[model samples]
Target: MRRSSSFVLGAVALACAGPDRDAAPASPTSSDATGTSGGSTTVSGSAGTGSATTEAGDTNGATIGDTTGDDGASSSGGAELGVPMFVAQGMVGRTTVSCDDGLTWIGERSWDVEGDAHLCGSTTPVDCSGSGSTCTQRWFDGSCSEEACDCGHSPGFSKGVEHGAGRFVATWGWGWPGAVATSTNGFDWQTTLDGDTFGGLRYGGGRFVVASRTPQTSLDGITWTASQEADFHGDDGVTIWSVRRFGFADVDGGRFVAYASGDTSVDTLISSDGGGSWWRPRSMPSDCLGEGPGAYGDIIAGNGVIVMVDGDGHACRSDDGGSSWTAHTITDSRIASSGVWTGDEFWFWGFGSRYSSADGITWTTTPIDAPDDIGPVARSPEGTLVAVNNVWLGYEQQAFLRSTDGVTWASLPDGDFTPGHPIFFIAFGHAEPSAMCPGT
Candidate 1:
């Protein structure tokens, strides 16, 4: 993991309206732990002063090398299960793949081109496979399937999505400003141009928030506003700077928290009342301040608390929303970039090991069969857990791991991505595809 090079250049004029918290979130320092900020550099933070203790009752129920674990059908939630979708954005093309049970995936060619730009129909499929499959049409020039134009070659990268209430809003961008595609049915989409650069787009508390360089919010997924502005304070509670960028954001307890790394310190941007407004806390955790803690990973919030963990085996808990933080050390350290709050416990992992905690203070470790780099973990609305490993056969191929209890993981079939292109994003959710193209 590395630190981001971008910084707030001019003096920030925004006011600091957040609470006087004890500490902020963690930053990455090692190659294993990457920061949420765009740039990758060595991250450093203060070490925890408290003693590290291991849990007594071992939770190691499954074999560490077993990849044939049972599919957790019993833990599936009441919500209707949709197609499991994954997006692979290479240097040239963006591939959207869907699976029924996550064991197999079928890629959807969102765009294609001939001598002249012509939209491929169900009879003549383009980049995706299938004889009679009508691929979901997406246009780069703000034109969806309604109009026929020759500008369908650039299928933008699908950044993230917010789905609920029979609606699906997916954000995508590559070079230019970000845009959104809203769909009542996940198959066909209506594209809208957005001002903010989309990275970590999230929807919570009835509002949508984008954690881009210039953070923006929207009541609906279309009309966006740059309302999340605040001054960042260092651990000393005096040095202030403008928030230039944000990363790793989550919504819980009616508050939206986004991590921001500074030149010398790290801070979190907080928004209460749904992404309508934002602020930064006064104080920060001494351990999280002044680059040296080793490695910062990701943030997960649930069960009335927000927890941030680093690759150096340190964990910080913020109980009063984003006000203050308490640091704790894990006995066994695992480098993890993504974590999931399973409504009962927190699970974070990297390659071979998995870490879990019920109270966010005392944590236990469970070795897994994962042998590659796990980037992000997504839980379906039906409670099925899916994790994406960046490397399977090599760096080119990607693998999917499924778990029902967040403990035992089963390796699914490998994704047939382009030979040298790596997958940038992965997601699993419920989608109501149109009757024309039922998912495979």
Candidate 2:
């Protein structure tokens, strides 16, 4: 276990030497523990903490090593029937995958993919073999059907967030008539809102906000009310065009920050009165601007700071909320797409690489050993970092990988949900029955 110390900027240092207004305090020093055996890392914070230990094998019952004990049971309790992790809304129609542990997954609970009841009623594990099979399918991206399932109604983007204890909501779609699903335990889900696609969904300022054609807010993630179009302008004092990406983060103190990425530059929107009204503090640095046409990413906040990473390896950091910014260059320029603040550090991942930074200013890169392209990465309630693989091309079946320290990874075997088309969205639920968190 290689331990790394984090360098955090104090709130006083980040405060502008002006009037002393009430500001959110800086977060405590976060500690992460990695287990050498299962490749699971336990992060410590308010969200919860997890620890690593030796496990038998992949959850899908595939033989990797001596995972099962003499009694034909896993010593790590991974093989036991546990809480199910619900997967919802993928490239095809309304489909979802569920897993108790990360090893075994069930469901490809699909609906109206080929204009038929194919794989719609069946709750059995996914079958990758056969003609017109659900396993070797891909969405309509000008790809061969045999190689991938090129179909319509595929999800463009999907996002989810925990609102309260045992309460969660997710929104996804490509165009109008998008869908929203809600769950109390991360297992059984129910669709609440349909129609009207939303680019992002977040919980902050005592309400749930969704960035759709127009921003919408909800008190319980069920009923919603629409707001005016968000104001997105560049430093040139002109509204940037072709907004491609949207993101939001809670900056504490009943305040929140929202981000929108356009073809020319990225814009920031700050809300002191929750989601009621938003204003722009200052424009981002020139280096934080988008590179080519239709290029954009998102911004993530943690430990009293906000960070934005684009597809061009350029990242901007803001200590005093999203009012001001500073740019930082990443070592690997492979277009960092998604990132998460693990309380201790920021972990970013793209196609073939993973990068981590203690201070969000300086970064170190590591090559990921994924069988195919890496899609979305999230920290499971168990404290394990779970990442999706093989989402781009349909040549191979989609899979998942788990990592503890971001250095070592383990591939789950082919089970019910293992051998299927890549899912566009993956998120960790607040309901953690396994209690994978350490010292819980």
Candidate 3:
């Protein structure tokens, strides 16, 4: 494996290889390991130790690559909270996704889009997939669904949530400045429009790590304040496409893991203290981050072992998150779309089918009832794993699918849930999707 520790224009002097693994970048001299601040080369201090014994967003051994084979999620309160499953529609009085530590999560999205934009609106305050089958009255902008104008997408609603006080926070990243929104319970929300595409999100250690298509961050979960901000639209290092809540692994301290498109190099990034800092990204051992606008990432339990059939073909495992990965590649032309954490395994869906892995690795693929593009994957605090597929064209495709286990797939009916805005997926949740408690 390549390693980097230097100060060249403040960019973390990475010790990695490109498509040519043989061309590993030289490791910086000892003094350089103690990186300096400022510029892209900056990665040091108590805050930037960049230790291999490091962790991003959560999901691995605090001692990088130290997989002892025991996933400590049972104690992380995951089991105690009943294997978080997505609640298609959070029962009004109760919070949607709750925590093992007694905290409740609420994502009450309040967006205002024009009529022409009706692929679907925030159907409910929380779960947004509506009867995309029926052509909406008109578009949000031009009555021609094609020109739908909007203020932002939706996350769903909120109710009486019980998060571990301070442990409960929210982060949203719309497409523009002051466009992001957050809420402790799906009821109250804070907004930001820093011009970042808020893909996936998670709340931890009193802050939020909002992942964008680029490398942007925020200090508070409700704001776009960052210790360091990068041009989210810039062409540079790692480019994270999505963010998710990896609360499955149950790491105690503040940390999070964001599955994103690494710069020209790595395919994923892990952040321990929200998005304040990042580790040198690593590429997927098998597939490249994909050519489609598709996002790639799979959650791991306490042991840092992931059962991912996400985006890439075949099942894979990353004992060290993406820092060091090992995957089983397949020639099948398919995408391992979205997934969830089952009490005993991980499940994902895509290309009209479903797949699962017991230890976050190895898999059993099969056909399912959902259409393509199942991006929003959530395993509620109640253990209902829900995955949604976005069919911008209507009944020609099914919008969302549900899974009781990471393997089985089903449909989420929009019976009573108020299809508030129309955010089919504001998905958060992963085994350490945010960060795993210390040891696994």
* TM-score, every prediction: 0.62, 0.64, 0.52
Q: Write the per-residue lDDT of candidate 1 for residues 124-194, one digit (tens) a residue.
A: 32322112334334344544352221111123334555553335566654333346656554455566544
Q: All models: lDDT?
A: 0.45, 0.46, 0.35
RMSD, every candidate, angstroms: 13.1, 16.0, 15.3
Candidate 2 has its poorest 10 consecutive residues by lDDT at 1-10
Runs off by more than 4 Å, candidate 3: 1-110, 113-175, 192-199, 204-207, 212-225, 229-255, 259-267, 281-302, 306-316, 330-333, 367-375, 391-403, 406-414, 418-440
Model 2 error, position 281 (Å): 3.1
**Candidate 3 residue-wise lDDT, 264-381, digit = tens:** 3323455554455555334343232332122333444433454334333444345554454444532143453444555565555555545555554334555554433454466554
The global Cα lDDT (0 to 1) of model 2 is 0.46
Clashes of each: 21, 14, 92
Q: What's the lDDT for residue 114 in model 2?
A: 43
lDDT of 2 by residue, 1-440 (tens): 11110111122121211112122222112222222223322222111122111112111111112111111122234433334353434443334444544454554433433432222233333322223444232233323222322232223234443333235677654422446767665545576676555556656544667763367777777787877666766555556422344444444343345555333344556555545566665544544443411112346666667767664555667676566666666533344335666656777765556766666665666667754444455565345665565223221445666676655667666553444443545555434453332112
- TM-score for model 2? 0.64
